[model samples]
Each structure stands twice: as structure tokens, then as C-alpha cells.
Target: MVRVLAFLFLVTAALALDPLPPERIQALAAYSNAHGGHALLIRQNGKTLHESYSNGHTQNEPHRIYSGTKAFWCLTAFAAEKDGLFKLDDHVADTITEWQSDQRRSKITIRQLLDFTSGLEPLFGLHQNDFKDRAAAALKAPLVGTTGKSFIYGPASLQVYHELLKRKLREKEQTPIRYLERKVLGPLDLGPQRYLPDPKGTPLLAAGFMQTALQWSELGSWLLKHEEIVSAFKPGNVNRAFGFGIWNNHAAESKSAREVDVEDTLDKKWHAQSWGNACLCRSAPADLIACLGSYGQRLYIVPSQKLVIVRLAKDSKPNDAQMLRLLFANTR
Candidate 1:
């Protein structure tokens, strides 16, 4: 009886230790504040361990997640697939028709678009404040590289995906945003999500999504429970560290792994294409997955530990490696 009780106690203690101690949480909170953090939330095994807001930010105030918005569209795509809208392997040319004659464009698949391997020109205008008919513009953009050849991180590829999805759902009168709400956000019970639209009224699929820290945490939770969406985390062949709108740290375990210096890589000219090869945190679990945005916004999920952490900020400054080290300290 004593031995059995000890084993049970060990399991319970392991489960309880996940979100780190209060002192460490306080340290992370301090780190966040020093680096322009607006909000932070950490959950383990479905329980909130820490939640804090600063700089006049409230718990429920909406904040732009920037590139983190990409993950939501990725999820919506999986949902659309489940609903029989189309398969990931389908050629984008099948719906767009405009690309049918262009051999390279005709070979672009829906998966490539979601994974940033579409070879579409990474347009700056799509992200600028002067939004126009982004879908139409994306359709008009020429392929800058061979299809499935390289990973180009930009709004243009996602915008092209928006155009494809729009054409696919045109007969149903369901806009991409509406379809996302119905299939992905609705089931998660997330939103009043703010999706900014272009002048021609197509939702900016790549960026301009706003949700509170709690709301985003809920998304992380939902992702943990959804296998179809989780499957999208598999690393793409073009960028071994990046999947469909998310970064997979597990790529470090692959035989083809290469170093990824985030600062140096991000500094390359937007058009100078390259692929990422390293894990976000070499010390963290290989199963770690992250939804990162331009301005330090982050949603980290570690399935191995049943952990979900959210950090929102005004700019990119926080170090994910350092944060993970603090969170996963050895309690022994």
C-alpha cells in the first residue's frame, strides 16, 4: 500500500509542477515587462497557472496577433478539408483556372500555399496599410520561384490561398472569413475575432487578427484536442522547421537538420528566399510547436508536457529560448 501510494503521489506531483513555481512566473513576468510585453498567460493540463497584463492592457482587450493569424487560417483549411471543400494535394490551378497554362503555377498545390512553399511573389503591398483588392492582386502576382522549391515568409502566399478558397466557396456564398468562423472558430468558441479586410473586402488572411490573451490561450487548448489540425504541424520539405502556418521545433531531430539563426535569417531581404532548419529552442522538447507573430506575440504548445503559453507584446524582443528555459526548470 505504501509503494502504490508513493507512485500515485509522484504522478500527481509531476502533473502539478508543469507551469513552474510562482517565483519563476514572477521572473518571466518581469522579463516580459522589460521587453514591451502587454499580456501573458500560461496553462498546463487545462488549468491556468499564470495570467498577467501590463501597460494599461486588460484581460479582455483585443490585440493584433499579426503573423499568429496564419495559424488560424491553417486550422480553417483543415476544417474546410474535413467538410469536403477540397484536399490539400489539390492543384490551386484547378480552381483559379488563370494558372492552368503556366506550368509552374499549375503545379502549385493548396498545401504549398499554406506552408509558404507556393513560390508566389512575396508582395509587400498585402501587408501595407493601403489594402486594396488583395485577392485579385494575389492572383495577378507572378511566381518568383519554382513551385515547392523554397520557403518564402510573406503575406502574398497566404493571400493567394485566400483567393483559391474564395473561388472554391463562391457557389456556397461563404466568404473565407465566414467559413473560418463556421468551421474553426465556432467550434472553439473563440472570437468576436477581429479580421481586418482589404479595400475590396477580402479578409487579410495573413495578418490583422486580434484576440485577447485568454482567447488565444483557448485556441492553444483547442489545438491540443484537435488531431486533424495538429497534423498540420508536420514540417514541410521546403522548410524543415516550418509547417502550415506554424513552426515545428521537432525539425531539429531530423537527419537533415541545419542551424537556424533567427535574427540572421529574418534579416535577409524578403525576396531572398531561404529555409529554416533549427528548433526554436534546442533545449525544449522536440514536440514543441509555436505560433509566432511579428511583434513578439507568441503561442507555444508542448504536447509532451501538456503545456500552452501565450505572450503578447508590441514588438519582437522576448527570447523564446530563454523563456522556455525558465518555464521548464528542474524542480529536483
Candidate 2:
């Protein structure tokens, strides 16, 4: 009996220690504070390891996740595919119809749109507060390049996808947001969560999702359990480091992996020569996938480590590689 009790005591003691050491946590806190981080939450092996909120922020408040919103739609697309809505390889022109006349535009595939290789012009104006009929605006935007060539990261491509998805659901008389809520968020219990909509009542798939750190972590957990859906995180050919709506670290050692600063990409320079071609963290596990947004909102899932981390900030600079290095310093 004594021996059994001793074993249990040791296990409890081990569990009591923070996964990250005190000094490391201090360093992270200082780094976060210096960079406008409001909340940071980490979970490992299905247990809460650490949670911190600052600058008058609390765990209950929902903060805008910005482009982190894209991952949800990406996962929803997987669900939509399973439900026979459309295939990833389906050409956008087949459904958009308007694109059929333009040879380059007709070549755009559903996969290419989410992968940011659709060659559509990256229009930031679709995200403006007063912009009405964002989907119409996106559909009307001309293709600036050839499909399957370059990674053009912006709201226009996703908004165009919104229109495509809208057309797909037209027969069923269901909206994209309603389909997403029913197919994805409802199963995950992530709604009653807020999604900002445009004047045409289309959910802004490119940005404007608000959820608390814990709520976002739930999404990471859900992704970890759904392997088929997680396959969307695989590195794409055009940009070796990006997948559907997330950044991948799987190709950190690949010769084709191009390094671009995450902070610089958010400055609305969607047409820049260098974008959408970098690992989130070189030192993190190769299976690490991240949903990053403007202003440092991050949802990181490390399946190999059985870990999920959510960080919410106002407009902090990205130091993902450094932060992951600290997080994994002692872990094997």
C-alpha cells in the first residue's frame, strides 16, 4: 500500500510542475507584454499547462482573430466536400460562370483559391467596413496572373471563394455561414460564436472571427482529432510553406521553402514578390501547423507533441520561431 501511494504521489508532483519553467514563462510574459499580447494559453496532452492575460484582458473576452478566421473556412470546405458540395479540383469557372470567358480565370480551381494560387487579384478593399456586396466585388476582380503559378495572399481570393460557395449552396437555399455553422462550428460547439458579415450578408471568410483563447484552442483540439480535415495543412506546390489557410512547418528543411517575414506580409502588400513561402517556426516540430492572423492572433497545433497554443494580441510583431523555441526548450 505504501509503495502504491508513493507512486501516486510522484505522479501528482510531476503534474504540478509547469510544463515551461518559471524563468521561461517570465521571458515569454515579458516578450508578450512588450509586443502587445493580451492573452496566451497553452495546452499539452489535453491538460492546461499555462494561461496568461494582460492589459486588462480576461479569458472570457472574445478578441478579433483576423485572418485566423481562414482556417475555420478551410476546415469547413473539407466538410463541404464530404457532403458533396464540391470537389477541391473543381474549376471555379464551372460554378462562377462569369469566369468561363477568361481563359486564365477559368483555370482557377477551388483548391487554388484556398491555397492562394488562384491568380486572382488581391483586393484589400473587400474588407473595408462600408464595402457592400464583397462577393460581387471579388467575383468582378480580374485575374492578375496565371492560375497555379504564384501565391497571392489577400481577401479577394477568399471572397471570391465565398461567392463560389454561395453558388454551390444556392440549390439548397442555404448560406455559406449557415452551412459552416451546421457542418463545422455546430459539431465543435464553437458557435454561437461571432462572424462578421458584409452588407450582402456574406460571412467574411478572410477575416473577422472573434473567439476567446479557450474557444480557439477547442478548434485546435478538433483539428487534431480529425486527420482527414488536417490533411489540408500539407504544403502546396506553389508555396511550399502554406496550405489551405494555415502556415506549415513541415517543409522547414526543403530546398524550396522560401522565408518571408510574417509581419511584413500583413501590411497589405499582397502583390509583393516575396510572400506566402515560409515556415512558421523552423525549430518547432515538423508537424506544427499554425492559423495566424493580423495583429499576432495565433492558433498553433503541434500534433506530434499533443500540444495546442493560442495567443491573442492587439498588434504585436510575430516571433513565432523564437516563441516555439522557448516552448520546446526542455521537451524531447
Candidate 3:
């Protein structure tokens, strides 16, 4: 792909793209103050930057990345793949004994789990149950759609996959948390973190992950460089096809969110891909910039523009369209 020098040059060049002026910084500050607080425009190399803000918190503070945990789990999957613990085609039922008796589940593979096509029926209305019970009930649940056919964007399939993987690894005397600590977090020098395990004492692989924006940025930057993370997945021949579990964020037009409200125009333009589990991530403006500097949320290596863009907000009301348009136009 793109050479490392080319990527670095692009990042350096992009930082010069209209550095947030005093007025804009003030506006962002005001915005952050109004909504708890925020950080802004913290730049690293083209591969990393930091934009963080909080109402009462400041930089280096911990926040619930919500479903951003999905991306983190994706990283774990990469680690697993790189270690050759399991192949993408490995059968989920084979990995988890409970599912083997169920013929439908026997057909499910790790690839299907990553693509949200496992067809596992969802276990709803168990917010009261601890993580373990919730996961157990989900495993016993029935299948709805045929495996690898319907794209049911829900939690049931992933939850089951997490439990299965956790069990499989645990049998080998491994756990997701340990795997992440030794393989991912530790490798990146990111530690002093926590991940809640299910009642059965397994890392909630599909969810229950927490980290600061800085930690998130570290993972994001790694992806932007096409470093070890993406190397785990053999890239698919299809441009936007899901390879392993990670979505390739190569272009703005390849996402599904672009058509969120504009159904009539869905075919006219592709939408932004959804980073499931975690929705749009939350961080200060600066942390987000670092992520964008390396194409954090987009998960692509765009050395030509040397630009990464990230927006973190509880709601999309403040309007990112105008700001992103301006940013892209100036950079181009």
C-alpha cells in the first residue's frame, strides 16, 4: 500500500490545513463548557492526534466509550488472528460445545460472527441479569435467519461469539482480558485499565470494555499506519467487503450512515460505516483529531490527504456536516 514516508508527509501537511484559529478554539471551548467539557486539536503525527473534552473531566480522564468497545474487541480479534489461535473460517459451534448440538449453530463460523450474519436470535429484556446470565440465555436462544444470509445488526450474535471465544480461550487457560493485556494493551504500553467479565468470569468480548481517549487513540493510530492490526486480516478482493471482523474505511462514500435519513438517495451515495457496539465514539476534540490524524474512526490508511477527522458527541444535533465539509474542503 501506501509508503510510510508518504503517510507521514500527508499527516504533516494536513496539520497545516487551517489550524483552528483562536475564534474557533474559543467556540469549541464554549461548546465543551456548555456540554460538561471538551478538549480540542491535540495533534500527534499524521497517524495520531487527540481531541478530548468533558463537562467536569479534563484530558486523561476515563469515559465510557459505550459501544466504542466494539472496535476494541475488533482489535482483540486481530490479535487472536495474528497469533494463529483460530482461522476466520473456524466454526463457532466447534469452538463452543453448547452450540454443537444445535445444527443451526453448527453452521455458524467465526467469519459469520464478525459479519453480524450468524442469525442467532437475540436475548432481549435482561438488563437486570448480570453479564453471565445474559450471555448464557443468549447462547441457548434459537436462531432466526439463516447463517451468512441476513445482516441483522443486533447484539445477540456478537454476544454469543464473545462467550464462545472466551470459553475456547479459557479452556486453553487464556482469557480475553489476559489476552488483551498481554497481546494488545501491553504491547501498545497501555495498561492500568479494566474490563468487566461475565458472571461466568469471562471478558465481555462484545461489550464491557472501557478506556480513555488516549488509549483509544493509540489503537486508532495503529490502524491508520496499517501496522500489526490490519495485517491480521487478509484483505478481501471486494473493496468494502468485511474482511475478518473489521470494516475497511477507505472512502467517505462507502458507509451506511451517509443515508441515515435520506432513503431516496441511498443508492446515489454510500453511507458512513457503523462502528457497532460502540456507536460514534466520544472524546475531546484533540483526541478525536489525533484519531482522525490517523483516520481513527474511518479505519483506513489515507496517506494522500494526511488528514483524520473525528467527532464525539452524545447527540448529532450540533451539526457535523458543515464542520466536516469545511475541514475536508480546506485540506483538499
- In terms of TM-score, the best-performing candidate is 1
Clashing pairs counted in every model: 0, 0, 39
Per-residue lDDT for 141-249 in model 3, tens only? 6677667665444456666766766776876798766776787677667874555545665444444444455555566555656545555544333223244444432
Candidate 1 lDDT trough over 10 residues, lowest sum: 255-264
Q: Give the runs in model 3 whose Cα sits over 4 Å from its true position.
A: 1-37, 41-54, 124-132, 231-258, 261-312, 316-323, 330-332
Count steric clashes of candidate 3.
Answer: 39
Query: Once model 2 is optimally superposed onto the true structure by TM-score, how far is the C-alpha of residue 329 displaced, in angstroms?
Result: 4.5
- Global lDDT of each candidate: 0.79, 0.79, 0.49
Worst 10 residues of 2 by lDDT: 268-277
lDDT of 1 at 71: 87
Q: How many residue pairs of model 1 clash at the backbone?
A: 0
* Residue lDDT tens for model 2, 1-332: 99999999967865664455667767776778678989998887678877999988998999999888888888767877889989989999999998899877888889998998888788878778678888888888877867788778888888888888888998999988888889878877877555667776776778888899999999888887776777766545777777788887875555665445676755645556554447665556778888888888989887765678899998556777777777655453
Ranking by TM-score: 1, 2, 3
TM-score of each: 0.89, 0.88, 0.67
